[model samples]
Target: MAKKDDRGREGEERAARYLEERGYRVWDRNWRCPQGEIDIVADDGRDLVMVEVKTRRTDRFGHPFSAVDRRKRERLWRLAHAWMRAHPGAARGRSVRIDLIGITGERPATAVLEHLEDLR
Candidate 1:
């Protein structure tokens, strides 16, 4: 795989671990529908969180969170709706929120991670 792809996967894993540690029950990774992909689907008790994981090798270009543009957000919203429709039982009682997990640096080192809630 390409270097950037590998980095992104690593970031997603890190985000999963972080959420797990915080008591989020992870339901899916890379949940896909016709609209787009959701990096993580987790149940946070009262809500379902659709997460976007962004990883950057360096902070020189920009922060990883900045990568989530308007079009991407819209696609994620559509995908989340599709996921809920496909699993109506899981959808009814809970709220939906879009979250962002930004990670910086390499593996085997301290990766800086930030969780931004309710992005959409």
Candidate 2:
């Protein structure tokens, strides 16, 4: 994999661990379809969470979370629907939520991470 890809995967692993520590059970990672990709899909007990993870080596350009723009949010919404359709049983009895996780640092273990939930 490319270095950037490795960095992203590392960030995602960190994000997954973070969520797991908070009691969320992760069901999927890097889920892709014609619409787009969801970095993480997890169950937070009462909700099905679709997470978009953005990782950066530094904030020289901007914060990682700032990369999730309007267009990206729209794509995530579509991907969330696609995921539900593809995994019907998982969606049952659970509310759907969109979440964003941002990580900034060279090392995954010591990265600065932020999670924003419930986008539109």
- On TM-score, the leading prediction is 2
Worst 10 residues of 1 by lDDT: 102-111
Residue 119, model 2: lDDT of: 80
The candidate maximizing lDDT is 2
* Candidate 1 RMSD computed on C-alpha atoms after optimal superposition onto the true structure: 1.4
Deviation from native of the Cα of residue 81 in model 2, angstroms:
0.1
Off by over 4 Å in 2: none
Error of 1 at 28 (Å): 0.5
User: Which ten contiguous residues of candidate 2 have the minimum total lDDT?
Assistant: 64-73
Task: Report lDDT per candidate.
Answer: 0.88, 0.93
lDDT of 2: 0.93
- Cα lDDT for residue 66, candidate 1: 88
C-alpha lDDT of residue 35 in model 1: 73
